[model samples]
Target chain A: MMGISEYFESARIAYQAIIANKTRAFLTSLGIVIGIFFVIMMGWFLDGLDNAFDKTINAIGTDMLYVDKWSWGGSDDWRSVQKRKPISYQQALEASKKMTTAELVAPHASKWGGKITYQGNTLGSVSIVGVTAPFVNTPIGNLKEGRFFSETEDVHSVEVVILGYKVANAFFPDRSPLGEIMRINGRKFLVIGVVNKRGTIITDFIDNQVFIPIQTFMGMFGTARRGVQIAVKAGSQELLDEVREETRVIARQVRNLQPGEEDDFTINESQMFRDEISTLRLYVWGIGIGLTGLSFFVGIIGIMNIMFVSVTERTKEIGIRKALGAKNRSIMWQFLVESSTLCLFGAFIGFLLCATVIFAITSAFPDVDFLTPYVPLHLLFIASIVSIIVGIFAGLIPAYRASRLDPVEALRYE
Target chain B: MNNDIIINIEDVAKTYQMGAETVHALRSVSLQIRKNEYIAIMGPSGSGKSTMMNIVGCLDTPTKGTYLFENENVATMNDNELADIRNRKIGFVFQTFNLLARASTLKNVELPLVYAGVKKDERQQRAFAALESVGLQDRTHHKPNELSGGQRQRVAIARALVTKPSIILADEPTGNLDSKTGVEIMRLFGELWKNGNTVILVTHEEDIARHAHRIVRIRDGMIESDTINPSPAEV
Candidate 1:
């Protein structure tokens, strides 16, 4: 424990030592500064990208489990497990009735090329989906205007349609699309609703899409006999695993699979999309943290080299102090303080550079909503600890050398 | 008659164990100095006068003898005790002026107080006062390089005196100075003696030696002679 004035005096000596040789001090701090700068900047950039990814995934739906023929997330396997025939629309209807954990089960049917037209104004062709009333509630798709078609309308095989918000905006910019007549794939359909501006979770929220009742869709453009997937919805996260298990068992029963055999279909959470984003996040962190660590290592090495020079240059000074009753530990502490101060200064500069870069990038890209300018306190904490650790580690050799210098030889040194 | 003994050496010796050889730097030297004794320790090169000074200043332990400083056996003292004695009882002025190169004059003079863990205000006041005593108060902020040889030596002297230690052990204090500067520095030491602090000067200069009340001469790791001056300088 040092008294305040003495502590400040020691710090002043360290400061003066660096000031006397500014160029050397800056050069020594260069590696560390660059290392941390790039690392922190990369971290912020990746965080922004991950935010974009999560928003894209969330646009599709929450709670809706995508039970398809393939695994839900990104995969490494080159070949898809030989395309198990797609789950049938009947099987989706059957599971909807059977699973106690399910809130709603939307039997979906779809095709990619559907040209939509409202009078003389024609919107571009898009992937049209045929779905149940439950889909609007389960995935919680937004309704920008009017309402989604009624379940009774699907039961009656009504020729009704719901336009995605983008389609409504593009083809009918000023007019209310509800109660208007539209044409889908040359078939007449009445516009019942316009879906709300989509969440930034999946795809470009402005991409054109149209939804019609599954019953009318099949009647109008014959069913493929095999549906792509039966989307299931769980009540809550607490029921997620349980609902998934029950859905799997029910799907097996509907598909007529016996016990002890693998089922034909896959059941997984909508969250799998976010998990893919997470694994990618891990890689981002890995690269960022590893690079930062490398810079820290390089910075510490530079500090160590300088400490050696400092100890040797001041060998006689250390000797004189020892002659005047300074202990080995005191000499060690002096050099440690010097080394630590250098590292702390470098860390402060590096963090500032990182923070500035983050701010600049966000300002440059205003639409990038994920950019957060405020650096987390944890990063500052980490930088401080790094500085202190570097001080102790880098100062060790010089401190030892200084402490071991014999008073007699030191005094004799010219 | 018995007087207060500040430094007592009894058959002290120092041997350096170099590779494949032993160099005898000190051999059975015995002497005593009471309080406030102004003495000059003089000898040729390799004569162990520096070695004797080191032992007297408690900077080194003797190889085969006892050194008692004010009745505390220095031979049995720990490093902390030696440091305590150095800071509290014996001040040192070196030949090279040994001021920390990057520090200011005030800081150089405050080094001992720093070791003594003195408060910053008191250290500054004391160091300033010591510099004033050496007639260097105006140059208190100047670094060694900015000062002349005489000024740097004054700063060194201020540092030596700032601790208010009993003995000012000056090893060739004026070795780097001109003859005129040397006499001036000797005059400063004479004034310090007049103020009642013990001053030990280690030099080969007979003129510098004449400034002290007693002279101890060494030759080849042993005392050649010890004598008192017939007529000491009147202050």
Candidate 2:
């Protein structure tokens, strides 16, 4: 067993040798630099992706339940789901009245691929939603400007509409959108409010939409008995499961389904969407780790080759050290220290490059919340450990060879 | 000094297998060295002088022999034990000065003490003292590349003496130096011998061998003569 001082002495010698041959050491460490760069970049990107997913999930509300005719996640039996009767708006209102655990309920319907226009400017392929006043109280429907349509407007079928932030910006870039007249499907409506920006909540393009009172929407688009979705907010976060159960019961009662018969409607939560996202994240992590592993393997080979050359070049020095009474372990430790130092130097450079690239990308797309990569502390810790492990593995064979050299033969080597 | 035999060799032989051919480097050599004895082994090239030096310095094991260092059989010791023996007992100076080119003169002198697990302050003190003894104390921080040839050889000598080993084995210590520098190194060896340290010089030069009190001549892997120098040359 070597003492602490001996190991430090060996490290000092290794450091001097590396400094003496700076260009060769840098070239040998290039592979490690590229490998660590990819690893760090991948880790930062995954962290950013997780943050974005969490934001989207928060916007969609973990404590709310969505009751709809079709499930949010894809089902195997499409024909059976299609055979069920549509969830009418009347049924939504009936279920809300009978629900015991819900704090509020709103009925919603939407149409897509329609154009909206103000004066000569037109926004194409915009989504148009119709909902009751209580819809604004849900997680993603907060108003950024103006007021929501009143209950009287919804009851009387008045043509008052609320625009999303993106829609409002397109129509009125310099002025407030309140009381502006916009044409939807060639029908004129008064804008009452604008929904706050909720950047890409799940798969929904919530910002590229406009909302109108349900009664006015039915009158303008002609309701053909199509299903409407019912969104219910639990009384509190603790009562979410209880509220979902009560909602299922109340919805079954409103739909007049028999006790033994399965309900045709499905209830969904943010967790379901999050689970699907997790599956995609797993695949990304696997591919990222595999590619990085391959690069690290190549880096280890490069370091090993360079260490062999170094041992050959320092044969006479090794002999001198041995003749001076250095043990085999001492010689081995010196080379190992040299290789690890090279790897750590490369890792530092990799971290700098990764940080710079992430900064450039985030700056270029300021509006994209998911594009801002973040380097977590755990990622840096793991990279340092991996670099050290690679160094030891790469330096093993060469250091052993050096330690086993015969002093007589080494001294004779030119 | 009392007649205490520090090295005892009996029928020590060494053989090497170069490819398929076996070459006998040392053939049944037996000799005894006492404390504080200054001896020179002289031979032509390929006369087994180097092989003898390697064996005596504990750098190599004899193929067949009973060699005792301080009455302990060194031929049976393992690599680590031999390394310990070499660390505490034997000092080696080579023809090329063999100092670490990148390390400072002090660090080169401190190398053996580092392997011995000595503390830093003590190691430095001893290394500085060794450099002072060789008249190179002012050159302690200078690297081997920055020093002249003679100064580099002084650093090597200081390194050899740092551990205060029982024996100093010098192999053509001045082979790379001019005649004047060579004599200066020989006088340094003479001073060390006067200080009661055993010095063994291996060389092919007659003038270098004349500095020793005893001279042993080897021819074709066998000792031809071992005799006391009637009047040794003074450096």
Residue-wise C-alpha lDDT for candidate 1, range A107-161, written one tens digit per residue: 7777776788777766665767888887777553467777787789889989888
TM-score, each model? 0.87, 0.91
lDDT of residue A258 for candidate 2: 94
Could you tell me the lDDT of residue A149 within candidate 2?
84
Q: How do the residues B1-235 of candidate 1 rate in per-residue lDDT, one tens digit apiece?
A: 3557788899999998999899999988998897888999999878998889888988889999998888889998876678778878888988888888878899888988888889888989999999999999998778789999988888988989998987899999989999899878888999998899999999887878888999999998888999998876543
Native A-B contact fraction in model 1? 0.52
**Each predicted complex: what DockQ?**
0.56, 0.74
Show model 1 residue runs off by greater than 4 Å.
Answer: A1-6, A45-64, A74-82, A110-127, A143-146, A153-210, A216-221, A225-228, A271-278, A360-374, B1-3, B77-81
What fnat does each of the candidate structures reach?
0.52, 0.73
lDDT of model number 1? 0.79
- Candidate achieving the largest DockQ: 2
